[model samples]
Target: MSEVQDSGGEKKKGKKIRAKKHSTHIDMTPMVDLAFLLLTFFLFTTTLSKPKAMPLIMPDVNEVPDPSKQTPVDDEDAMTIILSKNNRVFYYFGIKEPKVEQASFDATKPNSLRKVIIEKKKECESRLKVGGKTPNERHKVVILIKADKDAKYKNMVDVLDEMNINDVPVYAIVDITPKEIEMISGL
Candidate 1:
């Protein structure tokens, strides 16, 4: 706050005269204190964003597969997909050695691998419903993903993404068998 007051000066011709100017003073202490308090309050109340995490389910190395608790996935219900180099995909129903067939990565073409995955999911769900299974019981289409040594990493990622998109619940990346190598090597 500032205030001004007239200062008496020397009288001239018996008339009183006042000084022309007065120094002004201002108080900034309260404003500075309020600014610091607001700053401190905001610093204490603000929350920092936490890093997001992806849910990863790792297989237990020591735990063996229990037979009684495990419901056997029929070979006919299982689909095996093999990713090779040059954007090639080989898949088959049932075991890898006896009945392996080839598929293409192109989604536009008929009989694409994505269509096969959707068909398998529908077939598995329908079969479970016919067997009098409840909604709570998760009957998923089993798919085994095998990648060759020279397979593109992008192709492997794309296959995994397809599994997710198709809602295929039971899928794993398995080692390629010698028979599978020989079967595809003919191409």
Candidate 2:
């Protein structure tokens, strides 16, 4: 077999130099532009939903007691405050069914619940005093709060501040059932 040789003594092997048959070069400019466009689209168009929040730690389902066997809070000094989505404030003496109180709130004027809670605390204290007991009596002032999921966070905070100011320490955050929460959320 005969081999072709260059002037510099390099062997010219195989057929004459041929152009590549199937070049697979990709232009990254368009791809990189598309990636940046997608990133900008996500950054501008995405809407983050508000996070769910609560002050008190919620009880786990496993730790929750049986609803049917739950003892009623019959203590007259016990108070349950419910903040409905319609901005209504209900005060319950001892049961879950809270009585709607004619409470007013001004969004411009903050801490509006303070006055109402002060009055309610006075009334509760007076009732306990008439019953030959002081305000500091153990479990004499339980203030449970049941707040609507859509209720303003500020309102719940105001209620908590009022309870703290009134010295009603014992409190719990009532949780709604899954069904009730679904209904409230219109899901």
Top-scoring candidate (lDDT) = 1
TM-scores of the candidates are 0.63, 0.44
Candidate 1 positional error at 27, Å: 36
TM-score of candidate 1 against the unseen true structure: 0.63
User: What lDDT tens digits, residue by residue, belong to model 1 across residues 1-187?
Assistant: 1222222222342362344356667898999999999999999998888775534354576899888988788766788899887989988887634566677777877868999899877776666533555874645689989999999988987888888778777788888988889888877
Model 2 Cα lDDT, one tens digit per residue, 93-161: 655443444354553344355565565566665553434565564234567777766677776787776
True-structure RMSD, every candidate: 11.6, 12.6
User: TM-score: which candidate is best?
Assistant: 1
What is the model-wide C-alpha lDDT for candidate 2? 0.60
- Relative to the true structure, how large is the alpha-carbon lDDT of every model? 0.78, 0.60
Show how many residue pairs clash in every candidate, following the order shown. Answer: 0, 0
Q: Write down the worst ten-residue block by lDDT for model 2.
A: 7-16
